[model samples]
Target: MAAIPTSNASLKDALLRPGFTPTSPAATRLSDPIADTPLVLTLDDVLPYDANPRTTQNPKYDEIKESIRQRGLDAPPPVTRRPGEEKYRIRNGGNTRLSILKELYQETGDDRYYRFHCLFRPWDAARGEIIVLTGHLAENDLKGDLKFIERAIAVEKARTLYEAEAGKAVSQRELASRLSADGYPVSQSHISKMLDTIQHLLPAIPGLLYSGLGVDRISKILALRKTASACWDKHYQGEGVEFEMLFQDVLSQFEGDAEEFFFDRFQDELVGQMKKPLALGYEDVLLEITQQQRELRRSMPIVDAPSLPAPPAAAPAPDTSLPDDTAPGDAPPQQPPELPEPPARLAQQTGSQVQLPVTPPAGDQMSDEERQARIDGHVVSPANISPRVVETKRKVAAALGETLPDFNSNALIAIPVQAGSLHPISDLWYIEHDIDTPEHLREHIAQLAFEITQSVNAPGEIIPVDGGIGFSYKQPADEVDITETAHHTLTLLQSLSGATAIALKMLGEQPAPAAMDALGEFQFAAGLGQILLGQPTARDQAPDDSGRLSDGALVKLFRIVRLARRLIDLEIQEYATNTSELNG
Candidate 1:
């Protein structure tokens, strides 16, 4: 190596010459010191570092600006002179303050706002990363404004720097300890979750970590990632729906409440939407039914076995002699014939009844299909009802007589039949209707009302349309008034559901009579007028000039009207019976 020329002009000429080269300096000058003490620099002189861990936009920006406006900058921002450049880059803090100052200067044109005080320090790039991170972490910890993503970034920077210096990977606990020493006192678990959020979530959904997501929410999201990943893997062979895809869906579903919506509810909604196939189905329905069964069994106590009729009064001693064939003191020559033992009465099992097929007539010939058809017919009739249901309906019909509506046309009849359970139609109704509480039935009625209104079709057929039906009309008419009447009836039906539910709940607290009275009151309120409307009445009552709805609308309307009327009639009958029984 040769020594370079010391003369300035000679050095400049040599540097400027295209082909001329000079020997490398023994040591590079680390920094240029602009100020020996705290100093003020114009906003133009300060620059942001390329890899500052803190984000440029601060969540506390408005507050910082307001504070600065009220009380002047309390602390100087930390900066370091570039190794050879005139501008100073922030080593750690002051990005927010710098932004606010620029904004204020732009708005107010104040020279004081344009200038900022910063502490300038010397930099050594070789060890500059750790030094910068320590300052950055301290500022963030002090302000408590760094998002999980920012913390993750700082940890990564520290880890990389430490690994480069040490020539190995750093354990999570060791990294956490180092971070704690730098003022970011994070636990290993928390840092692990933050790192997961950064690596797995941030890349897929950028800026989500800045969306007010805290450590707990981040942890839940990470858990969601694991669940979705496993579910997707198991159900779709790691294909089909992606974890990121479902996560984004969940984020969108609960856009405003994502941070508060935990994994359990999210998993429920997700499972409902996706319908992932699994070995077992949802257990809520089964659990509810089991609970209802227990309640029902509790309500109906087991009846004691009936006492056997006393045997015919014993005859006098002369007539009651044990045997006449033998003398006294000698054993009877022959024992009286033992009375024949009565056959054992069979006991009913808990679930399911298996019926044996009836024997065909003697010498009668029938094919297997014919016999099967006969068996099916024997079990269920042409109307698709079991003999048991027919018997139950028959018994109810005999008891209530004309009070009961035609079962074929009256949908309301199903409610009472399902409720009374004298001969239950089947176990299916309880599960099918989801009738654990009165609310379930009321919800069904609301759905039915919507369906019925949507099915209206005939002019002569009265439909429920006003009041609780909530339909809008251009102008009121006679038909509208009739519809309003129907609507009022439907509203009464809904009220009746709530009343019935209340009565059932009261049964657990009050006596049976009180509960029944409550139910009667609800029914009486529902039974205001003749619920069933005749077609002739519907036609004659309508004004000639009243707007006639389309036949399709009238059909839907008729269905609603018929069901509402039947429901009201049923309520009236039920109330009458209940009140009568209480009075008796």
Candidate 2:
């Protein structure tokens, strides 16, 4: 509601001419007087602090931009005013808002939208870094809108800024706790993984961060960060391979500019490679190319011989005289020698494995240690793994019966899901608080049992491919894994269907422990059925990998045979109880 001055002189005059109100009795003891009254100025006077550690991308960005354009600012920008400068630097927050405002101003020439209202705070060079860093971190964390990469970047920046301010390195846990105190509740383990993704995986593939990929996409790849790094170290040995070359190679494999699509394809291929019993995966492929390069480098001489050499020349005499061929003012005439052209760069070798292009110019190469440092930063410390990673690993180990040595579980599940292969259980969640009749439930259970039985007997034959056999199931390769356990589970489910049907029939007439026992078996059966349908395959080999149903599907022939059995039991029990009461 308050209007402010447009310039330094008028700002001073306005501050002096203010009708000030005394602070309320409720004011906290720690409250800073300077933070009480926010500063108001034209948006032109507020400059974005380029070093503020936060970023957001769209269509998420587009959403925020549209929201502000329609609804205006919900929170004012936070800025720092210099000692004698007229302008204020937005230390943290409101960057997206500022961008939107500027855009709207340009589009519509609206003056009202051109003004900025912000909290004006004092700045100290050293401490200001911490303040600004923490401010943006808290703001983004509270909004819960930062993509995985953005959060990683912000977290890394916070650690760097804090260490710079305090003059000592802080442990990740300590930093996370500090951030938590400042209003962003985050765990040390999470910070550690985020650091790894931002510091390592992203640097290894520079353009990926900018290619419309989000945090979810980045985090999925970071699951294989260690394996990829090991592969990189094994093949390239030194940081001779440019990240751009690798990114370009990946980009070339897919059509269109939709980065997520490319990423999905890339991760799929990488996963398939990882699944190979003898494959070195992404690294092995890259390493072959490196070997070929070494061969070519060895064949070529370091320095080429001159095409022609000049004849031996005698020393010039002490000369005050000009050459007889030249006049006094004539330009000194000399013929220029033809210089030989440099040899052409080596053409990349053609193969299935991704080939690293010829080594880029010297300036573009990163040193081995520098590249390793980036990766090391993102590697999840075995000493402090996050709960999510731990749980994912546990589930994966149980399901697959093999330990993924350095792999993160979150990535194992996430990559397949993002690729549209595995679906979350939440997708099939239903709210069935009550049911009506036992006979009605029995009919439903019978129908489900018939469908599941038919599927179990249906031929799920495998077709032979170049290397291994691929399944002939109608489902896409992304939907299911062809594990032996899944095959057994389907068979067991078929047998259990008879017991479930009997239980449903018994419940409609009279309730008994036999019916209850049959019903109870439904839970175990359904759980396994879901796992069989939802689980990701060990290898990304075949095209029809996705099973007919998602992990969370209900009332489906392939995915939820057991769920149907359970629902029938629930209705039967309810009917039996009601009938008993009426007889009493």
Candidate 3:
């Protein structure tokens, strides 16, 4: 057996390089002189690509090893050496195959496994490591083997290398373009999600991600974090708790195999924990998350499926009637028979009563166009219009806080002229205020407090309060006539604000509410004032044309409601304990 070359210098000087003058007939007949030349080398002479995108062992490791052990290496992996480097590493991929070769050689001491063929190619320093990294990524992508996290990490590394090459910060679009030019195509949106995963998720749940969590699940996790974080910030009162720390704590419990990691389970636990700091309920957190998901889906581009060709038309039915003027074998083409006109109407007969087609009522038979016309004309009375039209008109009226005249009567719809007993607002959402017992009242008050938070933070046009009253958060394009409901809603909100201020001052003399410090007490009062005053808007300033409270806004409102309920419960418990002590 021939001795193996030990050093880089010895290997380079002794090996028959591809660019060297060809002596064999096969080499001389080659069209390209610089084509890669296959060389037999010991396993130790070559190295696996250190920057391979695949981090885990091949799933088919045993099968591939058995195949190689029986038949030997059928294909030689292309290898290249960087400038000033002695060892040759994989040019594109085959790290797994290389590893299996090493294992086989060790297990059996087989010369065939130890000395295998490798195709050598010269590396170009001008193209740099970006080319090599992308090559591995492309190869792994073709095999469909790399995990989502592995691909994310590899892409991030590519971003760094590209930035270094460019000598400045590179945008995701530019990175995507550069990658596509280099034979590995990744979309800009995909790059953004990958970066988000690396920055936000990898630190918190590395096990879940590394164990094979897919892109779809990772996207969901990131969106949930964003929504939950926003809620935490809104309700948090500089209390020592941090959203990231809380997220990490919650995520740690669910860390394990990615397959076993239930996303819904994790989401529930994370939201449940967020309730305390965010002062929200599970439904509230879920609402925000659901809204985020909707926005994401809406933003994604729609790809239409390819159109299919229509089937051929069926042949017309054959005419069986024979022609009258020709020979038995010869017949003329048949023509379709025209229908005769209708007979005179019965009403046209002398002394007959004039009859007309029976039709349904105009309201019942109204078309969409006619309904829209009625809505445009401010005809929104339920008695005169279809239920759907009435609903549409009500939404518009509630959003604008405008009262319209009854379509048939031409008189304004009845509204409370004075703020007397609390009543339900027609065509708007209202909080129930009538309670027979203190326990029910407490629950009602707690619910009202929760809704107040939603009103302040939620996005849309209608802000419902007590006494058939509502307000619009958005400024109208033109001057809006404030109806009785709008006037009453604002008045009730203002009164509630003033009353809450007085209540907070009185509560300050007693012990702070449970889960609240001095700062929290102040924050709670301030939050209520903001809600009552209609100061807060949804995070996004964009108009909500839907005219209803957004899911996110509802979630935020519920969170405050939950916190308010907890505080109320705590205060009641303290009062009960004090009264019992006095009696004793």
Candidate 4:
């Protein structure tokens, strides 16, 4: 029941009057009048700040506690009491230290721990809680131990407090500006990334984020989620499945350790799950995801690189040439020619073949007898031959009237058939010549069509094409040229259809006249191409009563465009083959 001195002078005088010995060097340096005087307070007199950025115990908690127990608290933590609040709380940081003091008191029954010194700063109601929160943020940041998730949560809370005071929503730029002004300087871009992590990743992988996932990794995860979600939305048709739900399910498997989590593996699993729902091959999905990732990176704000100190001006090259010595013929002790630095190890060798070092397997470590015995245990039998191989051999024998002879066998007996020779001569010829089968040609055409649809832009826009050129539908400007553009467009369409017909002929499938005619139609070809590419044409965007293309017409047009593209590819391929043959 003693009155605590509020003034620095009175507090210092009180300390001296009690014959109090300064605990450490810190206590002796109290010459500054504005510096708050340390007060002797017990555990019951103060409270830990509830909104401290650090949610977990300090990593060096035991070491810190041992230090406090042996040498005593070197830095007295600053405490403050809000207006009308009797309990004093941590003003900035020192939650860990305070907790350690409490633990030490409980374990050792130490009065020294309980009656520790704390610097009390008067809290201002006008300055508000934002100041206090930002103070904790700055302190934790200086320590450089606050987890990314913890920082994100603290910043979000600070944003909430700012909004509450303003009575309106604050943009991320304004929030960043306010935070910097208060003391915690965070960039707007960083704030955006932090908010993204909190909104998208926190709910799914809280344990991972809290387990020290850093800002770079968190940004990557956000980027991946955005890319994968965009690809999913493009192809997903089912009613109930959500991209976020799939993302969470895939992410749960990787929540063990943030350090050990392989992001690429997670991406593979997420994309794999989407494969079925999106009706896309794994490679196709990955390609789309990669494109989306590139777009995201392009859209991200560029941060300026930190300025680096200029290299110390190279010491004037030691005048190494002869040093003005009088020995004329002594070729200035030629320094050994500096060896060129070796090239860095290549991540991947391209164009030229590389000789890779072949490592021996575990069997190489075994004794010769053990290795021989292991090899002898395994035997090849007829059951090992694939059914397709057997069937192929049967067909070959039927056509050849005898089994193919194995020239490698030197034994004087009737030659048996060779397993490798079972492949038909015509099949081998086609494969060796790099000729595509009908099935392969169809697959190639379909893939090309899909790629083109993805690449082309909506009609009337400048669509990028090969060689960095763009194509756009030309609109007639004057009365004289009204039909000129239309005539040229129709002529191009006719040429395309004719070329398709020629390719179909090469495939040994006579082109149906009706099908060719449909492909040549401008409305059918252009309109359906637009629809399939997810770009609505002027006709399709027309009013419902304005005679828009029907669903059936669109479907028919899609088929025509597909057929035309397939035939065109075949014709181009054939022409290339003939040209090469003539050159040979």
Best by TM-score: 3
lDDT of each: 0.51, 0.49, 0.58, 0.58
In terms of TM-score, which candidate is stronger, 3 or 4? 3
lDDT of 1 by residue, 436-552 (tens): 223333333444444433333212322233333222122224454345434434433444334435546767698878877756665444333333322233545642312223222
* Tens-digit lDDT track of model 4 for 426-489: 1100111122233443333333322322232212222222211112223334434223223333
Per-candidate clashes, comma-separated: 15, 12, 4, 0
Tell me the tens digit of each residue's lDDT in model 3 across 429-503.
Answer: 121222223344344443443354344342223333332112223334676565332333333344443543554
Give the TM-score (vs. native) of candidate 2. 0.43
Query: Candidate order by TM-score, highest to lowest?
Result: 3, 4, 2, 1
- Which runs in model 4 stand beyond 4 Å of their true positions? 1-37, 298-584
Output the better candidate (1/3) by lDDT: 3
Off by over 4 Å in 1: 1-31, 34-36, 227-265, 273-584
